[model samples]
Target: MSEADYSRVSPFWQIEFFYCNSYLQSHSLYAKISASESPMSEMVEVVIDSIRVHLMAPQRVVVLKQSSTERYLTIWVGPYEAEAITVALQEVEMIRPLTHDLIKNIFNSFGARITRVEIVKLQDDIFYGNIVADAGGREIHIDSRPSDAIAIAVRAHVPIMVHRSVMDAAGMEPDREVPETNAPLARQEPPPPPSSDDANRLSVFKDFLDKLDIDSPDKDKPDSP
Candidate 1:
């Protein structure tokens, strides 16, 4: 598509990454894809897709495709990683201990706590993530899969942040606001009345002009023989 056409489309953000096999990729690629689409809408759709993909078994991989930048960020994850994220997105709780639950319990036992998750770098088509934690009164960083890190970070109430460069390269401008679809009808106010004081003043002025007789030619003319 032309650049102008692309710009006219709404901007969007690719928030989730997924993994897919060759067959799945080929089948999925046939779906409608547009650059500069609505980011908020896309995020909602991604969450819904994750739930659907994980219904039978946890997804091991997912790809985040950004049409604007034409970039595909592929993230490799384990089954547990997929299940935790997908379940969280679906707002459903599993009966047994999920992987993230076990990790959180281990951290609690060790008196270590997760502080944040950082998407620090992207190398060789692999996005690297780090988990920042407080252990022994010192901050420690552990290398982790972006998906796993995010899943744990969400459960631990830790912040998730991406590098500035990544955001700049992948982020799209937000779409413009749309007009109200169903605004209530407004009542019309009555018009204001003219001032009585101004009318009186005008009448007084006219009386003064009449007293002057400025245009009376008979009074100003010489006496006739």
Candidate 2:
């Protein structure tokens, strides 16, 4: 097909799927591609590897990503969503049930189950996700954050997927090295504590040493003898 004719057919077809800076950035690109193309293909698949909390906005939301890549899909979430996803990712202990935990509990209590999370659409720079659930003998769809949807998907043991068009636009090649933002925030251990016995011994040693100081002349030899 002629280049001009191909452009008229589909703009995405005209452009090659080159490398994306990051997966999230790639995803944003994919959304644009899908929008330009009428029907999206379902060939693309993505895995949710983990979630990260950015230091810049600890109070806001967290970022999500696939374990295999340095690129991340960021989501603006509430405090509760952040806490829930954090606990779930770290497997940390919480005295009280977190919001995500409660959601899972409610789902179980009502005989509803999350089947999978599908990143369905992207529009106006925003990515949208759908939670496929089986409840009351019927499947239902609910809107969710890509971060929260991913966190819950991990707990529910459901597959996480992305559209191929989105992948083509937003998918990035995975980097083996750790990302700068994902580095450890603080040292793992604190300095060892000083012992009281060692302090007392040092104090006594100082006192005895002070008595034999060469800086001072002997009192007995001071007089003109």
Candidate 3:
């Protein structure tokens, strides 16, 4: 090739180099942003232990038990939210779907999945949480009440988390030793024997009806007594 042809080749190489540099810069920026979004200090994983309610009052609380520690976190919630959390923990179906159920359905319809829930803050006796969801390539962080976040997390079978700072501030240990027998067991009931009154009620009723029948030709009319 001639010297002019060599100049043409140089421009092509320059363009290729520029494209590669631009791509690397864009990738590095994305990495930095992702790292910033998710810090190195990981949150502690937790599970919903129970929902408690005070008698004859609207006040309710949801208890979260740390999976990796012996600490617990309690967050007070409203009656409706408490019910939602209880329903999810019991794996019970409601006659009408509750708010959390509706949200789960909406997420499914949009092909989105809740990946995690984080109890990120507790300030002035109030708690805050976030729902991390994945919709295909996009991940979203939604601000939510701790109760609602937990309720949805149970239904989604997602990991529930507490910020290390939050745990350090509010985590509590059980006041009493937990009994090993307190663990859940399969419920069993004694079998009702065939001789039980309830088991013979139907046959007893049939016998009484046969004795009272008066239309049979061979019936003894009680000796006219």
Candidate 4:
């Protein structure tokens, strides 16, 4: 489909909108949205539904719920990282600037604005991310840890996205059958679950999900804009 076609029927609510510069072509990127239309991209927009921790070791998990569905993508992160994301999510005023706070201030100091943050890839159990920033007129993609990217995103109120392939691999829905919506008129291959290896590898993330501290994203989140 062409850009005009995508403009007519995108399902996203509030997603990333990137402007093209010389660096954009090198990256082969598409605009995730516009004031007028939601543009399609390889990534799916998600929200930081909640930060959860369990009694188990390495317990901190950051949950990303697909914007329009119950499907979730969870990433286990370090303690400091979890706290940074939590502080940002809760809009807490810290006594002193934390590391992420410093990063945000630096962005302001340098005149670079964060356009979006993405959990770009998942490989062997490690998740990779990018913080996309607009440096003057050029778009810069910075390599970042997923936790750091999310921490920064929440601070900037930027869209956090996961690649479709990563979602297919790690995303889980509460129910087995999803009543599909926003379907294209033509037939297409359904996305497959990423080799069951991920289920085994990332299974720790699902344990606290059913526990009391963790709440369903549907209830916690407001209706998307």
Candidate 5:
């Protein structure tokens, strides 16, 4: 779609579409969002960076990057939940259903579907999440840990959101190098890692624009020649 066409969509959906393409890479999520009334909750959309298993400690971390923002949130999770998120992100299917997969199946059989997951709070370094679903003609919100909530959200192809207050307080710009973990993010997926061609092309194009004498958005005057 053209930029002009995309601009016509509501900002919520603009982010939703971006999330679909960037993270899920599936149209199912887009379809689900479009079918529901826009949610009234004020939340910031975020995408999972990857599941990081701490090599130095017996713990796991799930990193989340706020959509269209520089802020990142890191939550410590258990190994089981870390594996669940890994399998969902990598699209790994087991011969027998894992616990998370079973939960999803139970919801499906009940005609309930997860609409979104929200990281609603952070206190004493612990983050909490809520799973929003529709079942029996009413909305249902279940309290959860950020890890388990994220795992189910990815499996359901639903949007994950973080409350603005929580993000503002706890989010940080990630370091130049992400820490090495027992679970390597790159190896989770089967496809060859993304080539740097697109990044290089975009970098070159940005440099070209930088060379032009363009005025800032706040400044109407042209640059001094």
Candidate 6:
């Protein structure tokens, strides 16, 4: 979409697209936000643990585990974004490009190399995140939902980071049993009440601006710039 044409589209979706992901509301814990100017120092690296269904509800959640740690961050995502994430992680060959795949392709076409994806803050039960990219020696940050950010990270083979404070706020201990493998984990302990979908969750496509390339795993690490 042309810049002008993009602007002409509804403004609600533009600002509200990333709002699809929310802190698993079934738990009683409250959210605490601490914004950081230096993400490298403040963020904790995490890996996709699994995508889980509520078991009893109509919701799907994407779980992020602190790398080499036991704590996990679980965020509820819409069915569409949840499926998009699963498809990317499973490397399901689609005959056509999904919304997120298209965004990665857009980044590649424009020389934007995705370095890392971060879940930066948690507030009002919402998980906020961003995509950081290197485009021609310049860095660009695009605000995104944790779910969407994660979807992109898996496709780009990048590391995912969550702010320390956010983790402290919403992160929870894993189930008693340990999975024997790193493959996607799943369980059912009766999830907290599913969150109601807000009107803003209707965004069809996350805006594709600038970004696209697969950087090395080392460069995609939390310590890398």
Full-model lDDT for every candidate:
0.53, 0.55, 0.69, 0.74, 0.71, 0.70
Candidate 4 TM-score over all chains jointly: 0.65
Give candidate 3 misplaced runs (Cα > 4 Å): 1-40, 55-57, 175-225
Candidate number with the higher TM-score (1 or 6): 6
Runs in model 6 lying further than 4 Å from the true structure: 1-37, 175-225
CA shift of 125, model 6, Å: 0.4
lDDT of 1: 0.53
TM-scores of all candidate predictions against the true structure? 0.44, 0.48, 0.59, 0.65, 0.59, 0.62
Count of backbone clashes, every candidate in sequence: 7, 6, 0, 0, 0, 6
Number of the predicted model whose TM-score against the real structure is largest? 4
Please list the residue runs of candidate 5 whose C-alpha ends up more than 4 Å from where it truly belongs after superposition: 1-41, 174-225
For candidate 2, lDDT tens digit of each residue in 1-225? 555665575546435422333455646421222232222257344554333333344433333354444544434556565556556655676788766677778888889888777776655546677666787777666777666777787677787766655544444443478456754668545658758864553453244323432343342121211
Best prediction by lDDT? 4
| Candidate 2 Cα outliers beyond 4 Å, as residue runs | 1-43, 53-80, 174-225
Residue 85 error, candidate 3, Å: 1.0
User: Which one wins by TM-score: 2 or 6?
Assistant: 6
Off by over 4 Å in 4: 1-40, 176-225
What is the full ranking by lDDT, best candidate first? 4, 5, 6, 3, 2, 1
TM-score of candidate 3 versus the correct structure, residues matched by position: 0.59
- For model 5, residues 1-225, the per-residue Cα lDDT tens digits are 898999899989988898878876654432233232324465889998755544346666677889987777767778778778877777866889888888789889989888988888766657767878898777777777778889899899999998887777667654367576799777776757546864543353244333432344322221221
Best of the two (2, 4) by TM-score: 4
Candidate 4 vs 6: which has more TM-score = 4
